[model samples]
Target: MDALPFALLLCGVFLFAGAVKGLLGLGLPTVAMGLLGLAMPPVQAAALLLVPSLVTNVWQLLAGPRFGALLARLWPMMLGIVAGTLTGSGIIAGAAARNASVALGIALALYGLVGLLKPQLRVPPSVEPWAGPLVGAVTGLVTGATGVFVIPAVPYLGSLDLDRNDLVQALGLSFTVSTLALAVGLALHGALPLAASGASLLAVLPALLGMWFGGWLRLRVRPETFRRGFFVGLLLLGGDLARRGLA
Candidate 1:
């Protein structure tokens, strides 16, 4: 693709992804990777996501009131995420890179299906200390492999019985740490190119703009219906990616 066209496509993708995040409180990186992986290689798509994901998630992380407490509690899990990302990134950037799309597709499909089903899983306080780092490690492995970071992390966090604001902030903190670790992994593996990084930085503007628009829409529109529809759409997109990968 030409430079101008690619940039335009990226802007559109991030804009839509950002809107989803603003409206639903998450999904920017997952949605972006699912779409971008259709054309770009998985490694490049992952690299492009690093900057915008980090910036937006950091903003989300700081916007909440319980940042210090959450950080203190989640530190072990966050460390595990960093460790797993660094460990798995080499495989993602190596000969196994071709399979990244398939992995991402599978991740998205599972996420959407789970969202649709809405299973209620509880994590009792007794188990949280051990579970946190284990879940974070698994999530980071998936993040490093496929550039999708939700999986077990989101569900695990949701099961913690946090209030709404704390839950959102916790998600943000997890994503920020995951994105930073992925960026470092990509850099270490030489998978990130200068041009792609630059484009990612520039794409942040459209993403923020779309978030503003989605936030406005959230105030005016009923989001439950929209969220369901979004997940359904993601399910289809993910299925298509998986099919293509298998083909």
Candidate 2:
């Protein structure tokens, strides 16, 4: 692709990804990675994800009122994510395109299927102590491998029985931590070059603009219906990724 065309495409991807996150409080990285993975290495896509994901997620996190309480409850999981990402980073940074594509495809597919199914999963108050770390660790490993951060993380958060705003805030907190951990991991592996970082910084403008637009839509549109459409898109995107990887 020509430089100009690629830049335009990258901005377009972020705008769409940002809109998704604004509407649903998640899916920014998932959408960005899925689309960008089609056109570049997953690691490169991930490097481009850092700034926008971190900035948006931090805004989402601070917009909530329950940060302290959520942090108290979710600290163990955050720590586990950091550790797991560091442990798994080298493997993913060195992985071939095919392996990364397969990993990304499977992760996106599973996330979409789970979102569509909307299982009535419940993580008992008692089970959370151990379950949180385990889930976070696995999620971190997956993020390290695929540059995507949904999976067990989103489902596990869904099971927590939080109110709507709290749930959204919790998702933000989790994603913020995941983005940071992934950045560190990529840096350690020398996968986050300066040029990609600069491009990622530039991508933030369209992302934020899209988020603003999506947030506006959220007040007027039915979120449940939009969520369904989003998941369906994910499923189709995931299947295509897997097919391309295997081919």
Candidate 3:
């Protein structure tokens, strides 16, 4: 693709992804990677996502009232994510494009399935101390390998049964840590080239704009309806990516 066209494409992708995050409090990396994987290598796609994901997620994290509490509770998990991502960085760096696509497809498909099903998995308060780090480690490994970060982590968060505001805030905290870990992993693997970083930085504007627009829409739209639609889209998109990879 031509430089200008690719830049435009990045803008469009991030805009949509950011809008999803704004409206739903999550989905920026999920949406961005799923779309970008169709057009580029997953490693490259991961590189492009680093800046916008980090910035937006930090914004989300600070916007919440329970940051200190969430941080205190989730510190072990965040630390585990860092460790697992660093350990697993080589997987994505060395993966064949087809394998990476298949992995990403599987991650997305599973996430969508879980979202659609709305399973009532629970994490008892007593078990969270151990379970939290375990989930975060596994999620980090998956993220390092596939350039997608939602999975056991998101589901685990859901199982906490936090109130709406707390849940959103927790998600922001998780995503923010995940984004930072992924960036370090990519850099360690030398997959985060200067050009990709530059493009990712440029994409921040459209992403923020789209987020602003989505936040506006949140006041008007029924979030549950949008959530269902988003899951359906993920299922279809993920299935197609898996198919293409296997072909």
Candidate 4:
């Protein structure tokens, strides 16, 4: 209720977030939550990102059979994310959370750029099995504290030589599971209330709409072009986070 006005502001944020995610296959929460966190409480901003995160990915996961393959391949990462979410959500709070948010904003920005530029930096598919849990834990801790993490994870995944789209599909699928579980865990702990939940849902519209556009745009972009553009956005985001932190 209190953040209603700001929540409405997130409508615009979600639009950009969606567009980027649609185009890049990730970065929704990093874009939306990073910007919003700068302007509001990190927890509230994260809570707001919750609904948008889920709805957008539901479609992404449905983009093709790749999502199915990703789920099984990256199972360990999923476990790490879940475990990290539980632990971080339980332990971190207040100013530390805020600090993490600021740090993460910079990380998100930089991470986005890195992943975008190196979309084809790949490893064997077998790597994903172990990667799943490792990145999951790392992302879980970062996201739990700051409510974002996949920025780093994406680049890590991109370092592998798999299909760029498929790499994205894998991250999106695992992230979808991890973030949703994060919201549920937070809500159950009474960290996110109905107002937060409802507002998060409303924020989803622009993001969802944006993703649709991104999907359309993805068809037109050369894989390398997409990677470069995505990384440029990442650099900007990193600078933004740094500014927020220093300010």
Q: Which parts of model 1 are misplaced by more than 4 Å?
A: none
Candidate 2 accuracy as TM-score: 0.97
Candidate 2 pairs with clashing backbones? none
Measured against the true structure, the TM-scores of the candidates, in listed sequence, are: 0.98, 0.97, 0.97, 0.82
Model 2 misplaced regions, further than 4 Å = none
Ranking under TM-score, best-scoring first? 1, 2, 3, 4
* Model 3 lDDT per residue over 1-247, tens place: 8999998899999999999988988899999999999998889999999899999988888887989998898888888788888777777777577888898898999999999999999899999899999999998898888877788888998899898888888888888888888888888878889999999999899999989999999999998999999999999999988898999
Q: Considering summed lDDT, which 10 consecutive residues are worst modelled in model 4? A: 89-98
> How does each model score on lDDT?
0.89, 0.90, 0.89, 0.72
Per-residue CA lDDT of candidate 1, range 1-247, in tens? Answer: 9989998899999999999999999999998999999987788889888888988899999999999999999999999899888987876687765687788788899899988988898999888788999998998899888888998898889989999999999999999999999999999999988988998999899889878888999999999999899889889988888888788
Each prediction's RMSD over C-alphas, in Å, is 0.9, 1.0, 1.0, 3.1
Expressed as tens digits, the lDDT of each residue in 1-247 for candidate 4 is 3557775677888998888887767778877776786677677777888888887776666766677666766677778877887777653344455465566666666676666545555556666677757777887877777677574566676665658678657766766876786786677557888988887877777887888888788888765676676667667766776676667
TM-score of 3: 0.97
What is the Å distance of residue 9 in model 3 from its true position? Answer: 0.7
lDDT of 2 by residue, 1-247 (tens): 7889889988999999999888878889999999998998788999999999999999999999999999999999888787877777775688686888888988899888999999999889999899999989998999898888877888999899999899989888989999999999999999989999999999999899989888998999999999999999899899889889899
